[model samples]
Target: MAEEEKPFICFKNGWNMKIEPRNRKGWLYLSLWMLALLPIVFTFTWLMNRELSTAQSAAFITGFTLVMIGWGFAMSRWMKVRSEVIDMNLMIDFMREREAQKKRGRR
Candidate 1:
């Protein structure tokens, strides 16, 4: 039989915490992208300071610009995904609270 999936939970100050997995994933991806970009950026900067043929400089500049644009796009996507995750988590928390209130009222 398949194992039951458990909800992600965090406990602090005797209270349960609800964390959105999507937000966590988004942050993880963003961090990974940043780590991966560090070396590429350093290399680009090093190349820019060196003497190079016109074609090589142009190529480096174009590649660097494209990388920056991609980074921006990734950041924007992470923001959007994080917002959506927060909204969904809020809804889930609301429902859980409502259910808890109903159970208390029945007692």
Candidate 2:
């Protein structure tokens, strides 16, 4: 039997999805560090006009991964879902076009 088709918006179904959400759990750890550090580093220096310290400038680096939390999974999931939907739609259109051409040829 053919595989059942997934719902169009179901990223959790993992059909044609490059990475599972389970595989990316480590990102949460990274994001935690980032969330803690970004505010301390950027707030006093860039936003507040505080002078940069060799250490303050460097403190920002540790939080880089945490800041990524807001975007990473959401963006990757969006991209994967979009790519699969586009591909499925393209396949459907191509098959319809082929069928139309075959009917025309028969006339």
Report the alpha-carbon TM-score of model 2 versus the true structure: 0.31
For candidate 1, the per-residue lDDT at 2 reads 100
CA RMSD, predictions in order: 9.4, 9.6
lDDT of 2 by residue, 20-91 (tens): 223233345445645866665565456336566777656665455455565566655554553323445556
Which pairs of residues collide in candidate 2? 31-66, 34-63, 34-66
For residue 51, model 2's alpha carbon misses the true position, in angstroms, by 2.4
Please identify model 2 stretches exceeding 4 Å from their true place. Answer: 1-48, 75-84, 88-107
For residues 53-82, write the lDDT of model 1, one tens digit per residue. 999999999999998998877755554444
Candidate 1, after superposition: displacement of residue 66 in Å? 0.6
